[model samples]
Target: MRTLGLTRTSPVTFEEAERVVDEDGHGDAEENPDGLARVYVSPEVDGWTLVIGPWCDPCDGERAPEILRLCTELSVRYGRAQAYYYGWQGDGSAWLVVERGAVLRRYCETGEAEDEFFALGDPLPLERDRREQLRLSLAAEGSGDAEFEDEWKWAAFDLAPEIAEALGVNPLALTAETRVRGTGVLAVTPHRT
Candidate 1:
């Protein structure tokens, strides 16, 4: 089964998203040359997963809104949350960070050293300063300064409100913890020490 888009007329959940995709036969098994099979929907600890085949012409524009809506619902229910989108080409993947029903940030790594960050809300200028400090720290740790050169890479600005209100801490005080994940990409875990 294949769904062109998620219906916004009603609430959506991870299970519901999975059911829609499965019922539509979108999850049919197919051989993957790169050894990574396409995943339509799967359960995750933080939220649900959606994998779009690289050849799916409408996946990015049409299906992404539905996924984001489902993710937003999950975030509202689960406090801090995540909704992941993985494209089975060129190391395409995106992590949607949500907290208290708000989308705080989007962290994406499409290839080696091809990292992107996007902030969604207004925070104080101090947050930007703190983020710059964190970027410098990441650069010093060998993640490369180029990753921080992009404005979107400064995700801390978007996360500052949540950090200050929900987490109850200063963004500057949090220690930067970078790690290599299963995808063979380096990312800074969005948690404080």
Candidate 2:
């Protein structure tokens, strides 16, 4: 796994990362004392995980473009890379797998993969209905907070087939063999096989 342009200083415990994220509202946006970007490590189903920019605010509408630009820059620097952005609001999110600065696959709500949710050829109407049902279910279950809502949105990329299926997206299509590149900005362990 590559660091993806992030600077890894001292190791941080998941508890500490969670605390900082809880206080600051973002894990990847902050800089360390040396003025380098900080990457947080947390536990994941596969193994430990490292992630940046799970930004969850609808107010940050400008962030999408910035994230895209950053993705482009990172792809240029790293050769091949994948980027995913989730929008908490109705705008939906985008997933891009790029290689050598060219996008191998681009998936989004309004793109070629639009109907490829949870299942290939899932009708748009059905997808919308299922998403609405999920939203309502989350609301009723008292998981309507911004954080959980953000989690719900990002569940589309879950490595688990059953989880992605529950979210109305095909697990096989969602899988990617992404190599870690760049500095220390990105890396997932144990790396997805």
lDDT of 1 by residue, 1-193 (tens): 1232321133344345344434333434233332222233322222222232222211234344555565566667656544444443333444455577787655444443534323243433444456665654433322445555443333432442343333333212333342212221111111111
TM-score of 1: 0.34
Put down candidate 2 lDDT per residue, 78-131, tens digits, no spaces.
664444444334345455544455554444432223223312122233334555
Using all chains and alpha carbons, the TM-scores for the candidates as numbered come to: 0.34, 0.36
Task: Give candidate 1's error at residue 53 in angstroms.
Answer: 9.1
Q: State each model's C-alpha RMSD to the native.
A: 13.7, 12.2
Model 1 clash pairs are: 1-24, 1-25, 1-26, 2-24, 117-152
Best by the TM-score measure: 2
Q: Which stretches of candidate 2 lie over 4 Å from their true place?
A: 1-10, 26-49, 55-60, 85-93, 106-193
**Model 2: number of backbone collisions:** 13
Task: Report the C-alpha displacement of residue 3, candidate 1, in angstroms.
Answer: 15
Q: In model 2, how large is the Cα lDDT of residue 28?
A: 32
Worst 10 residues of 1 by lDDT: 184-193
TM match of model 2 to true structure: 0.36
